[model samples]
Target: MELVSEHVANWTGVRLFQQALRAAGGHRFPALPAALPDANGGSLPADRAAVVLAELDAFAGTARITDEVELIDEATGRVLMQYVESYRGVFMFGPGFQAGVHPEGFFVLDRADPPVTLFRAARFGQRALPGDRVEFTVGGTRTVVAMRPVGEHGEPPPERLAVRTRSRSGGDFAYVVEPLRRLCAASVATGNPVMWC
Candidate 1:
């Protein structure tokens, strides 16, 4: 099944991925190193569910996990990731900010100044203002371009103007913003690098 644009075979892979993120909590960026367990054949650690549960409790904020059982299911990770994107108005590489060819890879949008700036703001604990701007090279000349108010009246926030909400069969998924915000906060608080699996 496809979760947030990536394909995963079963909920086992989702559980394993969540465990990896929890294990890498407080880890630094560009150095979030962890080995992924095989989705089909690999088994999770005996205490992994507890660890993830604790992590969720620690970072739950206002966005409580409506269904704890979903934590072990692939839909939870995918839904959470979608909420993060919808709330933050940014496109994550895979799940969160980290992106790679495989689920384990992490990346940053270095080429674009505005995205990098906004990413830094969300990664840290700053708000990206609507008046933000950065220098961009056009044709050969560098010009200052506006970064904020990206959408009409800035309704969709920053980089999320282009995000198309997915259609779930059971109406729309109930998504809250606090969970995603707190997830970013938890990452900064623990220095645990966030990634998408």
Candidate 2:
């Protein structure tokens, strides 16, 4: 019974193969043809074969296939890579955002080891946004060519809240607006008048 089932499956596969050959042309060979026959019977469907071949073929012609890679930090689960091609168009967050304007459209490359953000410039268009899934190249170092917004736009929260500081010296001592966070305070100049204070 097992052998019979195996034979049945094999027959089904052969039938499918015959159907594919008939679809490509009309003739079917007795045994699986070494290669698909061409319209002129010179070689298998070069065009169709080219579509299936995987290894880099220098002779057939240049084909562009976009893909993605996840950039993850080995030390931390924190996603260090963004704009991976495999993710489709979703953008991943990196340890830090690039200060410069992201190019119009390009995929974000994520590195696995030691985690790094690299941008691919030429392969993008204007459709990519921050946090979008995108396909990109894996070879060579990646560089940012363009970028798109990742999610809905919203006002960023203030880094610090203003507070009143009193000078010990004397006088009425007008209320000084001090930042809630030391880092925020550093960004404010000493003399800048704080409206909230």
Candidate 3:
């Protein structure tokens, strides 16, 4: 999930790349990076070992090429349809849409027994950021929700919610406070506890 150097990897991602290359016509490209040899230099190095990272760095340029790419099943060599790439780095198949390419809408259902859901935001045109309370009604499939802003010093925030502290950093452990019975816990670092107490 994390991108680290193949040379420093506990297991080489080179194996995956090699498999992908084989599926993409290995010898056709001619710029494939050579795999690192083992101590015996007889075969491809172990998959569970770090690889020579420079070898991988060498392939970056060629991999970006928009050559006719098809994801094929290795065992059967069956080319999977709808997994084709038309232009460089753009997918014309699969879900037909890429994530994070467009902004995502988020929802938080507070004061309600259930939680908020957003199958599609355009259904309601709801706009909300994190730490925001939205009041909305759920449609049959796509939920329609709206944010209910809290009045500062005028009224309490929506139930089951508390005012965030100055620092939004996490603590060592995670716990929840009761909306009705919660206590104010503000710890100040001072030499004399009695002074602030």
Candidate 4:
């Protein structure tokens, strides 16, 4: 993410005033510079001024609060819990990808045969941040298997297991079939080549 110093001048001015107050032998108190616009017209409300003073008193350079959570590991089926203080952004992958967020972290899996690609869904709502480790239940019960490919030689070869040949009026169209084992034979055409080892 790009960092823009939108409020840097304002914050710097506040810090300078606080420093001057400390150097003046007075109790260190936060002071608003005259240039800063008051939340209430030209004057700050008593309650708002008090809150600002309290915030300055409590400010200890560069301190921030953080929170923790749990995530899961898809490969080992392990549960990993960790802290995630902020949401940076998300990494996007194309559609139909199934991924899980565990205490170990978030990861996309390749359920297709030969594991075509490791991808994360484009829209996974409020799941987890990049660094956060969380635990989640694996959804969807269906399992896919690898189908042997019939090669041009009419033999199933291991190397050709991912390759399928289809006969068309335009001649033969060759395609590398996705490895989804549970699909019925009717779903696949016979002339389609499967190079099975």
The models' CA-based lDDT, in order, is 0.29, 0.27, 0.26, 0.27
Best by TM-score: 1
TM-score of 2: 0.16
* TM-scores, each model vs. reference: 0.21, 0.16, 0.19, 0.19
Per-residue CA lDDT of model 3 for 170-190, tens digit only, reads 110012111100111111111
Worst 10 contiguous positions by lDDT, candidate 3: 179-188
State which candidate, 1 or 4, has the greater lDDT: 1
In candidate 4, what residue range of length 10 has the lowest lDDT sum?
169-178
Which ten residues in a row are the worst by lDDT in model 1?
67-76
Off by over 4 Å in 3: 1-50, 63-117, 121-125, 129-131, 135-142, 145-197
The TM-score measured for candidate 1 stands at: 0.21
Backbone clashes per model, in order?
A: 3, 28, 4, 30
Q: What are the C-alpha RMSDs, in order, of all predicted structures?
A: 16.4, 31.7, 23.4, 28.9
Q: For residues 1-197, could you state the per-residue lDDT of candidate 2 as single tens digits?
A: 01111111232223323333333333322222233221222422333333222211221122221222223222333333333222342344444433111223333444456534465342222223256432233345323433333221353212211111111211111111011122113223332221210
